[model samples]
Target: MSLRTALVAHVVSSSFYLARARILLSPAGDNWLRGRQRHFEQGGVPMRRAFAASVALLSLALFTLVIVASSAQARSERTQATTITLSGWSAGKDEDDLLQSVVNTFNSTHSTIHVDYSVINGDYSTAMTARFAAHNPPDVFYVDSSVAPSWIKQGVLQPLNTYIKKSKYDTTKFYPGLLSAFKVGKTIYGFPKDWSPLATEINSAMFAKAGISTPPRTWAQLTADAKKLASSGAVPGGKPICLPPDWARMLAFVFQNKGSLASVQSPAVTAAVNYYVGLLKQGLAATPTQLGVGWPGEALGKEKAAIIFEGNWLLPYMKSTFPTVHYGVAPMVKGKVNGNLGFTVSYSLAKDSKNKQAAWTLLSWLTGKKGMTLWMSKGLALPSRSDVKAIGGRKPFLAAGPFAHGWGFPNFSTTITVMNNDLQAVINGSMTTAQMLADVSKSLKG
Candidate 1:
């Protein structure tokens, strides 16, 4: 019989024995026993009856103990199973599937902790904010490097330093740049799950049609090739390159010039802006919107543009959507330095989580070497942990990690908004490069 069935039988038997003993000890039962003893004259009837009652009582006590032990075991098992909620924003179907696979692996391996994952379909920060406000935030959630500074300042996240210290988790195994994005002072708030570095995606067919034998390796070469590609009418819209005017893409140019958004008026910043503007003026490059596409990747995939700058995330999208298009990925065209923008998201624990310890176990397993290796093996994003080697197409992204810079800062959100607006004005010929820089500098200060 099953253990539960056996326990139920023991409980029932014990109750029956105890009930019989109670009846036998009653006044009526004692009088009957005396009558039997007088009639028998042997007087051994009372002694035999008393001995039988004692044995029944002992059996009842033993069954009762067994039942109690079984109940305790069931309670302990229930107590050991902890369910934790993990929330994150969905990147795409491939990334989502890969993450779910990893989570499934974690759940299967861990007996005590269970992670219930939910993907926020809309704005992740806004959704997480509402959860925090309701005092029912998830045990753990994703924190993008772009908004980490703001989230950290808001105190919605729990610092992982104590847990890291107690568990002796090797924090040094992660890429230093990616790790720094989630840190404030000496306390780390999250662990990077994965990262993507910006790189150039070129269409070999388009290059060959334009009579170009090689891809550009430097900004000057890129401009020269763009000119030839545009003049040759290799692409349908006659645009040689499509570059998004957003700060994420522009930041690479700024950093390569040894400039920073923090110092918008620096000579390096001005040069970077002017160079991009010049390309637009010469009709060698067009923004993705101007090319009538949603993003640079789409522009390239649709053959609306010959060259574009994008990250590793584009690879899967292109392969699935535009499989026939032949393309090659190269490191970002060189400037003063071999600079590329890195985008990363980390798994952060909620400060108010009641199951903080359980949540940390899930977080550690997800970002641990084995988990990261499994996740990265799909080639969706490069592994953040140094101990986990990059496989397949992820190697280039990993190689660029050491030199890449993450896009996280206290004022990064504000800077991105202001810079994008001001740069768009410059590209439209409504504002001069100097004017754009001065305006951005003034806005940043305010």
Candidate 2:
């Protein structure tokens, strides 16, 4: 600083101290500093002492300024760390713990981006709906195939094409069917972290007792096997097959019959539904609920069912919950083609997120090959990325990823409820299959 400016600053500092201590400097807001000699001569203290003190105080003030500037920069840097909020629903405690560990790993390895994660264990859709309603949803969250369409329609999810292109992220690494689940037209909204396709879980002992050495490869064979198991009377508490009255399961059948959602009222769709309900009607297959089980997995664990169609998630559940339940995994029975519903979730970005870049960093890392491999190693779900190999007996689930039908429909929550209710009604003899087809066709159209 200039000499005059330094002297003026010194006077201001000295004057503050003097006011506090009830003392006085040449007081005129440093006006007397311009006439330093006259002020020193008239103000009655030794001029040398005053000049020396002012110079010392001026140097101190400059030092303090440097410290303040450096401290401010440090504060700025600390505040620059981007915080991303992530949310999802866990399949079980093990899956929850696994995901939390992955999140912890990400946070530790990343310096610029930090993630705050939460698991919405109960009704994840409702919780996330509330967040989006308030325009304060988490930066990234699990967007399941069933909800992707509706969320995209609501404009809560941002398109990731720009971020992907800028980051040069390898989208091609993901299974095309799984990745396309979150894509609306050509614009990709998110990347699948991992995926699972419906696969048959057959109780080998039950099949063996029924004298069936091979798992069914086609719907006809499945029917024959179910019949043999039902008539054999060797099956335990469960029936030949334990199926759920879920629209998701219905979609699997619909796809297997070569019936797309585009042809909801087609003959193929009707035939698929008939065949599924036929097994139930003939007492060969029973809904898990009818067998006094919470879900198909529960039925499988309790040995209540000889077979169940579930995702690779069943493998982990079987290992932890029912270790003695010997089973083999096979692709879902084929109809006109090999059809399985791909149950997948993507790490989707929120449209209202202020930290888009940081959120993308976390989302991409979780979906990237390395991060996915770390997660897939736990063997809870099959890797969505083609480059990431399946661990344990995950190959059956992984093999279906490329050709699996990534099924989803508009107004999915409502549509699923309707479809499931209708299917169950038909199963319980409250409605005819024709009636269900007509009602669902109307709903699907409307």
* Tens-digit lDDT track of model 1 for 375-409: 97767778888788876676656767777787766
Clashing pairs in 1: none
Q: For each candidate, what TM-score against the reference? A: 0.82, 0.80
Candidate 2: tens digits of C-alpha lDDT, residues 1-446:
66677646644554353353332234563555556656666776788578767657655665555565577677886688788899889777778888889999998898777798888878999999998999999999999898899899889999999998899988988878887889989999988887788888898898999999988888889999998998897477779998888877878888888887777778888898888888888888889879998999988889888888988778767888999989899878888888888888899999999899999999999998778888976777788888888788777777687688666777776777788999999988999877887777677665
Indicate the residue-level lDDT of 45 in model 1: 71
- Pairs in clash, predicted candidate 2: 238-304
Residue 341 local lDDT, model 2: 84
True-structure lDDT of candidate 2 = 0.83
RMSD of each: 7.3, 8.1
